[model samples]
Target: MPDTRSGDRQMAPPRPRPKRSDAEDNRARIIDIARTAFAAAPDATLQSIAKAAGVGQGTMYRHFPSREALLLAVYRTDVEALVEVAPSLLDAHEPLDALRLWFGRLAAYGRIKHGASQAMEAATRADLKSQYYPPVVAALDQLLTACKDAGHLRPGADADEVLLLVSFLWRAESGPDWQERTDRMLGIVVDGLRTAPRA
Candidate 1:
């Protein structure tokens, strides 16, 4: 006679992992494609992005929901790429130089994002509020801390102020000469950051 023990229990089948929605997957794909196009050519159009992504216009729309949405994603992707390189910059270069390198990268990123700001600005005012500024700011803060620790920057220089200066330089200068200008401006900024005792 088979007697079931009180402790005996049939194991239930393992629960299946929930699948990601097609919309989520497609959204990610669209962002990847958009980033490729934006990187390859900053002025890439939506049609071009759709072609590069191997998705029809409707598919792109279904995923991104709007051009502004796609543009924000593209901007965020570019910023993310720059931010991801920060740790390596710190490791590979001196503390002060690492900050300079990151600032240079921000300038380049701004150049790539030249015309996209209008769309991004509009999106920023909307409910989306996903313009990727926080990551950029955080990256700047990391670089600033490194510089400060190395005594290469002024003790009280605010990260926001530095970012604003960089943004201003990026907006005013838009030519091949901009690189040299950026370097010079960076030098001035760095010098101002140097620890100076109160007069």
Candidate 2:
């Protein structure tokens, strides 16, 4: 055995280090900035986003190799936030009210998706829809079921149909009055789901 132990140790791969807290904070700040930038303009540049985030181009590229990567990351973050808020909202409010509030957040996310989707490749968009649709629908279903169980919503109210009804959030043209219009439209949809007036 001619230094067999040393050779075995050299052949072992080094373990990867977990990301530092500072690095994670920087990444989160970049995503937040990029989300706002992309919602304002679909073609916002990566350099501009990095500058706005107070990070160097090197740091930006280290976290996200390209514009598409950053966009995807931002979308992923938004989706996760949307899903995670449903339970808390339900706990804090009546089911119908919770559903309405969750939909408000969903509408905001729709605005971001509308702006960002234009810059994404068709395949990437399709992939994102496939990956994210289930969890979103599941969250909606949870809220809808809560409302139904409480007799606040009609038994026949379907989550998929409700989602379809609100699809206009992303499809509608953006203008000064867009928020008012969407809010009114969402109210109509929520009202339609009600079974009867609460005593």
Candidate 3:
């Protein structure tokens, strides 16, 4: 009986330690600075970003480990934010309005992606797209389905096709008037997706 009881007992797995508050703050600061630095200059050095962030090189390295790591973190943060806001937008507004608001966020993310892509290698860019594309499409689908259910959008509005139609976001030249141009283009696309009223 003693032998059987001993064998039945098992050790619990060790819990991972939470990051210290200061470390979390430093990491967040570094990413915030890196996003601006990279956007302004695609080849901005890690040392400069650390300095701009007011963190030492050692702290930056501990958090990001490499330039590519920092870039990915920034892009991933943007994507997560973009996806996370969809539900809240839908909760706060009508379905079509929520979709339009989400597109505005997507346009902002496209700007960040345009700049970050210049610094990433071809394989790295491909990997980012694969990892991020699904969640983005899913978020869009959520909004689109809500719109269709509410009869605010055409019944056949497919998320994938809608995303494809908006692909010009990243392709359009980011000049001084880029925001205005993209906004106009997005409005056109949204209008096209709207359900036509019965005569």
- Compared to the true structure, candidate 1 yields what TM-score? 0.66
Q: Where does the lowest 10-residue lDDT sum fall in candidate 3?
A: 120-129
lDDT of 1 at 157: 76
Instruction: Report the C-alpha lDDT of model 1 over 20-45, residue by residue, as the tens digit.
Output: 68767777778877765654555577
lDDT per residue, candidate 3, 1-199, as tens digits?
4555766878679999999999999998888888888777888899999989999889988998888888888988988999899999999999989999999989887877777677866316456677878988999999999999998899888988999999888777678998899999998899888897433
Q: How many residue pairs clash in each candidate?
A: 2, 0, 0
Flag regions of model 2 displaced more than 4 Å.
Answer: 1-16, 122-126, 197-199
- Scored by TM-score, the top model is 2
Q: What is the lDDT of residue 77 in candidate 2?
A: 94
Model 2 Cα lDDT, one tens digit per residue, 1-199:
5566765666668789999999999999999999999988898999999999999999999999989889888988999999999999999999989999999999999888887778865316457777878889999999999999998999998878888889998887778897898899898888888897334
Q: Would you list the clashing residue pairs of candidate 3?
A: none
- Cα RMSD, model 2: 3.5
Highest lDDT scorer: 2
On the 0 to 100 scale, the lDDT of residue 120 in model 1 is 62
Scanning candidate 2 in windows of ten residues, the lowest lDDT window is 120-129
Q: Looking at candidate 2, what is the lDDT of residue 28?
A: 97
